[model samples]
Target: MPMDSVMGRARALWEGLAQVPVSFAPPGGVDVVVSPRSGLCPDGWVGVVALGGSAIVTAPSDGIAVLVRDALRRLPVEAVTDGALVRQVLPVARVLGPAALSYVSPAGFRAVEAGASSVERLSAAHPDMRRLERSAGYEDAGEAALDEITSPAFVVREHDRVIAAAGYRAWPGRTAHISVLTAPEARGRGLARVTGSLAVAHALAVGMLPQWRARRPDSLRVAAALGFEEMGFQLSVEVEGLSPDFSDAG
Candidate 1:
């Protein structure tokens, strides 16, 4: 996978979340591709394009920096309530739940998306699903993927169950990060393999390529099986706190 592909997927991931009605989604900020497209911001935006990474991006005539300036100008997070956590905390802003699990699907992977339809499929037999059941992320959430799978043109299921899982964050363009584990019982049965293939197919159908992180050979095999090529090693760049640069970031 080329870096561009990974970054594009990252943008798609964030955009997908942001596209929902503010009243129906998480409180995270939108994805921004900035620049010098050069030095990255240490703080991550939409899980793509870390501010200070060594990407060596050349600022084009319409470099991402301009887009950042324009977007921030319009959003004016300053005008919005200054919540330390999410981008907007104003009483007027739509209240959304904290999010867990991020995954992307190929444009037409409806079959894969469909596979996760039944939350019940996650029964006691599924290992990953079972683990998810215990996770702080999904406690009582009741099949988080149920909503995402049902919504967004895509769907992700745990084995046959629809478990909302966030994954495969393609930081800047195409490489994605996936860290979802199903109930311990669901492991080894190859549910993730099937679902991941579906996602890769869907992404490819729409020209959004997919790739597996080479670090984990097993996971990489899943991607490779779905036509995903290795793109070399990957690095994780997260934006947790407000970097000093954005004392105004709050």
Candidate 2:
């Protein structure tokens, strides 16, 4: 698909996720909305997603909405998604992320040509997939989001052990949320890029928009190398004393 079309789909996805009736923020500006839905975060927190040239903040209540709006009013759109800036502006009890949000168009994706020769594609339900996750442990496995994938797993094995793997989950707007994990011992071997390439190829074949949400430098670099453009950021902040007001939530 064309880059513009991909971008339009992305906007719609975020709008639906935000549960707002507006386009994303304008250049250098922020748009705040209040609803019961928590966009990208858990309940009683703020979810901020910045895309294109604008940013959107979803709050659980009108009161929290005002707090976010007032706090972010003077900042540029870019700063709105900055975790540190956001934490400083509000009474943040915790922050989930300020992860890099990237997407690739079929026309822009640069597929890896030969390195993934040893990869094997299997059902996500395959038990070895979970074994790989266990091997990677909590942090690496969670960051890869391997547990959430709904697509076929592309894996690399060593002595019958799954050492690296990648896949994606179907998301709204026909988007594919890509996930990749490489065992600690398998690091620095480019296994991630290889397995990830296979998974991305599968998503593109099925006409899904591939998205890479990464917080680590290595993961970000892998996305960039695979032709994904970093267009935005996603930050979820937990505010002190914030509680859901279901009376007006939608």
Q: Provide TM-scores for the models.
A: 0.35, 0.94
Task: Give the per-residue lDDT of model 2 (tens digit) for 50-136.
Answer: 888887788888878887888898677888888888777788888988999999998899887545347788788789988888988
lDDT of 1 by residue, 173-198 (tens): 44333333344445555555555554
For this target, which candidate reaches the highest lDDT against the unseen true structure? 2
- Compared with the true structure, all predictions reach lDDT values of 0.34, 0.84
Show how many residue pairs clash in every candidate, following the order shown: 46, 0
TM-score of 2: 0.94
* Candidate 1: clashing residue pairs, number: 46
Superposed by TM-score, candidate 2 places the C-alpha of residue 149 at a distance from the truth, in angstroms, of 1.0
RMSD (Cα, Å) for all candidates, in order, is 13.4, 2.5
